[model samples]
Target: MDRTSVVEVGGIAQFIREIGPDEGASPPLVVIHGGPDWDHTYLLPGLMPVSLHRHVILFDMRGCGRSTRGLGPDGYQPEFVVEDLSQLIQALGHHTVDLLGFSTGGQVAQLFVESHRRLVRRLILASTTAYAGGDHYLVGWQEYERRLQIRAPRPAWAECRHGEGDRGVRGTVQWALDAAPIAIWDLDRLDEYLALLEGVTFSGEWLGPFREGRLHAWRPTNPEQALRDFVGPILILHGAQDMGFPVQVAQRLHAAVPATSLRVLDQAGHMAHFDQPQAWSSAVLDFLGG
Candidate 1:
């Protein structure tokens, strides 16, 4: 059975949505959505397929979506999010869970695993980077835009690429709108994926700090070294042509953690789950030993 409710966790109301069976041998899979600002809604229909075999949980972190918003700068820390997930899991009666963090969510996952290592049975980091300061990502994005220019190039590409203008939410949204089409490798599925994010809401309060790179203050000084101590197995799943974080970052992560299994889907970009749903789901299910 599917269910949705508002669970008060750590004095903050969190919007939680669960799909699939209530009783099962496997622990529930708690998924963390990307965007320090975006809610859990955009992951729908794409990640919903996993519910067929396992109970899946998705929630809006503190200041996003249906969850409580307007928490000043102090309440929006990454550590607070980690603690929220920990408390939320216990409140839901889950002793342990399989966790999947996508994009920026994956960054939070790293923080989660570091402090709450024992709570996660297995972890999946998708479309994210281990290196907090992504120097290589800039080079990959240039190539991504070059390929995009061949098909459909927006006028804002030049300005957005250099980070020359304002760094406010307006500039951020404009950049995302102009470049979103090319973020997916398969142009055919672009509209289908874009449709999922319609009417989506973003937390400007959170974005203000996030855009300034202050939200990730909890990140380890050396993230690659930190991954070596994780208690559970990890799966680095990414799209070969990802424009945002880039697949090479995933490759570097895979190389750093020799125990991790890496799966890269071709003809897919940042939203690989939407681009290649079957392949993406198969990889995730197989990794969880389903």
Candidate 2:
């Protein structure tokens, strides 16, 4: 895996990891990570199979991961992030490419495709939804928060209340706040994930803009319009048990898109790629024609 930085559309430098394929391979497939706030590390291993066929490009979106941060209100808006993706594609000199977006990143990708249909060859939306307005979608968010609270660091009340001086409490608290939700399979990965989160400093500037932008709320007032607008082939993969962005959301997205295929993994939850890598990878590979 070769790591480097590239100047993308938003005047922001993007941190990218390029995994080159065997000699004389095809153009790369760009993998977009989820989380309006999360980074690219979690999606890396799951995409190895796609990398086997072509070069794989992974990057940190603005205000997330190893990418340049502190851009104030300009950085967090979903439109700008889509622009950033467009610029990155141009910067890389690719006229058209395969794109795979997970969770929130899928929303960004869908917006991008809606705006620039010619640039996308194949589209993959995994563990994501079309509109965020549905009640089922909020279930996922609530579950995420509940799980987060459980893994949160709790110090003795006396230490915090009396200021008894336990320095470790601060670190633990920070860990709980920034760390991504853990998978049941890998207990040790949480530490590594926490370390990565600590490395990327976040500016609260995007918070206000994010809340105002309402990027989390997906209300496609004109689903028919969106369907009529985009003509690219799309693949929708969702976990049957996903608490965040329930399976029904994926179904809605599939129903709306004119050219789409839907795959629901039975026993998986929110993070299908992490929870069921083999199944996820096989679906992606088959869709992309591996």
Clash totals, every prediction: 0, 3
Q: Which candidate has the top score in lDDT?
A: 1
lDDT of the structure predicted as candidate 1: 0.78
CA-lDDT, candidates in order: 0.78, 0.67
Q: For every candidate structure, what is the RMSD over all alpha carbons to the true structure, in angstroms?
A: 4.8, 5.8
Candidate 1, which segments miss by more than 4 Å at Cα?
A: 135-143, 147-175, 211-213
lDDT of 2 by residue, 12-99 (tens): 8887888756424344678887765556776765687566666778888887767877776654677777778888889988888889
TM-score, each model? 0.87, 0.76
Stretches of model 2 off by over 4 angstroms after superposition: 8-10, 22-26, 137-149, 152-205, 212-224
Backbone clashes in model 1, listed as residue pairs: none
